[model samples]
Target: MTSGKAALLIAALGLSACQSVSQFADPLAPDIVREAGLGEQILNSGDPNGAVRYFERAAAATPDDVAMQRSLAIANMRAGDLRAAERAMDAVLASDAATPQDRVERGFIAVRLDDWERAGAMTAALPPDLDTARRALLEALVADRARDWSAADAAYARALAGAENKAAALNNWGVSRLARGDASAAIATFERALATDPKLFAAKNNLAIARAMRGDYALPDGVESDRERAVLQHNMALVAQRKGDAAEARRLLERAIAAHPQHYRAAVEQLAALEN
Candidate 1:
């Protein structure tokens, strides 16, 4: 199947399994609530364009519904219509009908827009219990981007304490440490992150880079068993190329691309680097 078809199938399967799609009616139920629920169903079923139309209708029919607005914003974001997402979020923010959940959802949207300050402000409005691990992760990213390393570390520490995003927290914390000239500590932290979540692609990717930086080429322990083994092998080949073994690099790269034909970036880049 085509990648898009596969993605749509997965989306449809996921929606079919979700209680949120089947059990939860729109907050207002009946009237616009029913329409909103149908819209969300369509969105979850991988038809973002159709979902947007329904959500737009629901939002217009009930302008006071912060929930519908939030859903519309999320649909827009998923459809890669950033401008529409921004408009929907703005509409939600302008509405006095917003609940804490709305604020939190808006915070998430702000993070996607790279408006860290706005995200922080919206997150501040969320209740403590509702201020989730995701919110903390966004705060950490914002702090890290702004060069507030201490705050970033603290936020990541808090986020990981919840145990939901342990891998991401550890990986980002390692980056914070690396920025501070602590290569060994960064490596150790990344290793710990990998141990905590073996399937975390970002952690694995960063770990490889960190190891390469230290002139260490050993593969991380879990790669052989990973679903991303092909990608990992490709990364290893790139690393070999960097270490001046063009012949072995080309061989490994070819092996990886053979394993996963969709793996293009690594194969293409390594091929160019070797030929040059």
Candidate 2:
């Protein structure tokens, strides 16, 4: 899937997901806050682009409003506009009113941006007392990047322990297991994550990936949308490609296009890439 709809969400916890524009009290213009609030509602409704429109209005009205900027940053991230998020988050961090959550948000963005060094810096600078689960998850991701598997495992444990959202932590752990080439273990972990939170999209998507890695090409049980199915098929095709099963990858991409209700350009493109 594209980054906006999702990315297997192996990283990028989407820290600001379904959260209010600002965790702190809103002392700014009510109009800006209300506009941002509408953006948050729209974001939660799965229209990041629509959310961005509302957030951009808020930002334009009060460019210096840190709270508004916070919402804008997350809105842009959800919209798959990391460059916009980067600028907004950087401005947020530069302000005296910035909070630890803002820094952590930046760290996730950095990870998505493939700037592991910057992400690590933000992770290292994070305070120990705030949102331990997210902090530990960040540490785990950075550790995994450094090839420090032991550190990653330990941090994932801590993340699960303090996780306000246990399914998310478990899902990430499952992805980490997949990264380690433990498909069986990853499947079990993903199953556990799903059992804990049946609606966790990443767990469902990752479970399909795990199964595909284990040589199962069937779609997972709960993916109801054709678009989602197409996305999952594309992901499985990538897994097949990675395993050098070009034939299987091509077949899956073909299946992806067939399953899609409309033009699945991504699947078509992947098919082209695989064939060529």
Candidate 3:
């Protein structure tokens, strides 16, 4: 059988006994259970190293336990151990006790690994509804990476409508709109994201682009308070060019590059625009 077929077969077989496998010896010894609780706190606190040790001990005691395995997998991924993460995912998928959520998370790892074909195939098999929304988001990410603009736009819109302000979803959704020449709508979406989180670098950078497209020199109100305002000013120059004011745009671009010597794209484009 092909890899895709093999993966599907594995998914089908593993899903059959998910409940039973998850019931494997609960690694809930009083001390260990306390550790497990603390691990969750650490995970929530974004301390992957602390969480990993707790999860590792929990998995060791409940070797075949699906929940422990899932925790282990997530901790490993957070700790940047991709190989260990894949191994945990394999164990989770091989058991008859894996949940639909397990399969979805496996698909997530595949996407992070840039295994788009596998992500597409695995997500295609997920149950619809909430699962479908998650899959749609992943497909949007894959499509964005692959430069399939139309599919990406549709997928992201679906995901955003279902889960508002999901940072990655929102950022990519705006990207798809920008890709398709829907600058106004893209700008709106990007700005909404900025409002949701003032310090999100990707949203800030993207919002700058959208503002530049509209021929505006303003940074997203207060974003420049913390971030380098040179980027915002540089983007404004591009907006000037877009609005057919090449001279003003060139001057602004030159000023930006002078202020920040690393603004290579702005400098090159401004010089080229001047020549033309």
What TM-score would each prediction reach against the true structure? 0.65, 0.73, 0.62
Model 2 agreement with the true structure over 1-276: per-residue lDDT tens digits: 332223343233233111111221211122222343634466566777887888789889988888877888877877788889899889999999877767777887788788999999998887777755666777888987886878989998998887667887788788777767667877898899889888777778788877876679888777878887888888888777766799999999998999893767888987988778
Q: State the lDDT of candidate 1 residue by residue for 146-187, as single tens digits.
A: 777788788777867754556666776775665555668777
Query: What's the lDDT for candidate 2?
Result: 0.72
Worst 10 residues of 2 by lDDT: 18-27
Better of 1 and 2 by lDDT: 2
Judged by lDDT against the true structure, how good is candidate 1? 0.61
| Candidate 3 wrongly placed segments (more than 4 Å) | 1-39, 129-132, 145-148, 164-168, 179-182, 210-218, 224-276
- For model 2, the superposed segments whose C-alpha errors exceed 4 Å read 1-46, 225-230, 241-258, 265-276
Highest-TM-score candidate: 2
Better of 1 and 3 by TM-score: 1
Flag regions of model 1 displaced more than 4 Å.
1-54, 100-104, 116-131, 178-181, 224-227, 236-255, 258-266
TM-score of 2: 0.73
